[model samples]
Target: METVIITGGTGLVGTALTNQLLERGYKVIILTRQPEKGTNKAVSYARWDIEQQTLDISALQQADYIVHLAGANVGDKRWTTARKQEIIDSRTKSSELIFKALQTNPNKVKKVISASATGYYGITKDHPFTETDPPADDYLGTTSVAWEKSIAQVISLDKKLVIFRTGMVLSKDGGALKEFYKPLRFGFATILGSGDQYISWIHIQDLVRLYFNAIVNDRLEGIYNAVAPNPVTHKELVLAMAHAAKGRSYVTSYVPAFALKLALGEMSIEVLKSVNASSRKIQDTGFQFSYPTVQEAMEQLFK
Candidate 1:
């Protein structure tokens, strides 16, 4: 059986992707800072220290493929100077560790798949951004550029590489959806800013499937936007989500940009940013999205 080693395999995307890989009969090794014995026979955990820049070399030698998803949650905290550094370091450092391990070790790793964010396109854009667009000169863009660059070094090692620029991942379990669902319990459909900002999103299941597709489909190289076909405005998304949850019982309320800025500080820029990214490139590869629209995704998640 083919073996795939994943960094940050305990996160939402990683956990979902792990189940997918295991169900398909692939051996899964999760590289974690804290190694633990897994209950599943097909799953195991290895040690990787980003601080010391160390990795379990034995894991690298056994991996047929590598999926790099280790990174700090950018929205998890206020973006203080130190927090911003942590965000960049978490992604780039982990990537550096993976690349270094693969470089020094004699391994059979054929392809490497890494996750990047749609923030590479910048905070807001009117037109749909493609993979060819230049990385914006902002914090998010620069962070993504550096993170991808760290992983891109694997190409020099003659290993195939695939990088996915992901958008907002909507999952019923946790993530953006859970936060969106928060106000709904009290019958409030809280809309952020003007609520017209476009939200490029993909279902958690679909996102995991995209990773699986890259693993099996060799044609997928370079970068592709991991978003649903149809992007929705923030207002439309909240209304649909509210409809799914409480029919028409929820009250639609707008949260001013200033309020969000005050509450979130600098991180509010991302919460209010309108990023319309295209999935055309991935779709052209004959890859279909199981949940191509927000409405459909909401129905599935709420049903």
Candidate 2:
């Protein structure tokens, strides 16, 4: 059986992807700082330390493909100067560790697929940012540029690389979806900022399937934006969620941009930034989205 090595395998996206890979009959090896044994015979864990710059050599040799997902949560904490550095380092350094391992070790790994953010395109007003668009000059943009650059080195090792500049992923288990539901519990549909910023989002199922397709489809090389075809504004998204959760029996409240800035600090820039990214490139590959609209995605999740 072909083996796939995944970094950040315990995360929201990583956990879902692992289950999908196993369903496809692929042996899965997750690289973590603290490795442990799992009950599944096809699933195992290996050790990798970013600070030490080390990975299990045996695991690397066994990998037919490597999915890079290791990184700190951008929205989890206040973006302090130190925390911002940690956020950038977790992605760049972890990728560098993988590249170094592939460079110094003898591995037959064929392809390397990694996760990126729609922030790569920075803040776009109405125009849908495409794959060919230049990386933004802002914090998220520069950080994404550095993150991609670290993994781009693997291309020199003759490994095929595919990076997905993903947007907000809406999942039922956990993520922005859970947080969005919080206000609904109080019967308030809260809108952030002017509620005009566009939010590019994809359902968890489609996002995981995109990664799986990248692993199996050789035609999907280079960067592709992972988002739904029809982008919605922040207002449209929250209202839709409110409708999904409580029909039309909910109060609408707008959270001013100033309040968000005071609360989220530097991170609020991301929450308020309007990023209307396109998925046409990936769609051109003939991949169909199961949940193409916000209503469709919300219906399934809320059901």
Candidate 3:
């Protein structure tokens, strides 16, 4: 069995990915900042500090493949200049550390799969963003592009590098679905801004499987959008979530755009930006999405 070392394996997606990797009979190695998190017997762990540029080289020595997923959560805090830099560095610097480790250490690592975001295409209200679209000039666009470029450097060493420009991931345990489901129980969910922003999303199951596909499918290279084909507006998304969660509905009211701007600061724009993303490129690779529609995806989650 091949060994796969996943950076940021303690995160929500990483936690799930670690399990899926183990079930497939591959030896799992996780690089984490926290020691207690590496307690899983089925998975091995190494410690790394991206800012300090410290890492345990032994993990890379044994890794056959590496899935780069470590990054600061964009939604966790207000996007001040320092916070923005933190977000960018957390991703790019962590990746640089891995690349440096690979270059300096004797390793058998063959391939690298890194997680990116649909934000690369910026806030597209009309045009359906595809992998071929140029990276936007906005903060997210530039940050994401930088993130991808950092990981893409590994390709120069003749190793396979695959980047997934992921969209909003819908999962019951955590992520956007959990936040959307929270307000549904209170009679009405808070719809962001005008509630017209197009949310290109994917079921967590499909996203996980896509990662597995990237690992095994030698044909898949470059950036592929990890999203459901049927992207929906904010209104439709919240309503669908409300219906799924106990058949309740959002009180036909939206949180004002200005109020959101005031509350969330610059982050509000990101929350409300319409992103019409595409998953066709990934689909063309013969990997079918298990949840192709929002309704089917949400129903399964809420059921």
User: Which portions of model 1 show Cα errors greater than 4 Å?
Assistant: 37-42, 123-126
Over the stretch 55-113, how does candidate 1's per-residue lDDT look in tens digits? 88888889999999999998888999999999999999998888888888899999999
Residue 100 of model 1 has an lDDT of 87
* Best candidate, lDDT: 2
Pairs of colliding residues, candidate 1: none
Please give the lDDT score for candidate 2: 0.92
Query: What C-alpha lDDT, on a 0 to 100 scale, does residue 178 get in candidate 1?
Result: 92
Between candidates 1 and 3, which one is better according to TM-score? 1
Summarize candidate 3's per-residue lDDT along 63-143 as a digit string, tens digits.
999999999999889999999999999999999998888888888888999999998887775678989989889899999
Which candidate do you rate higher for lDDT, 1 or 3?
1
Clashes (candidate 1): 0
TM-scores for all candidates: the values are 0.97, 0.97, 0.97
The order of the candidates by lDDT, greatest first, is: 2, 1, 3
lDDT value, residue 12 of candidate 2 = 93
lDDT per model vs. reference: 0.91, 0.92, 0.88
| Local accuracy of candidate 2 as per-residue lDDT tens digits, 71-132 | 99998899999999999999999999999999999999999999999999877855799999
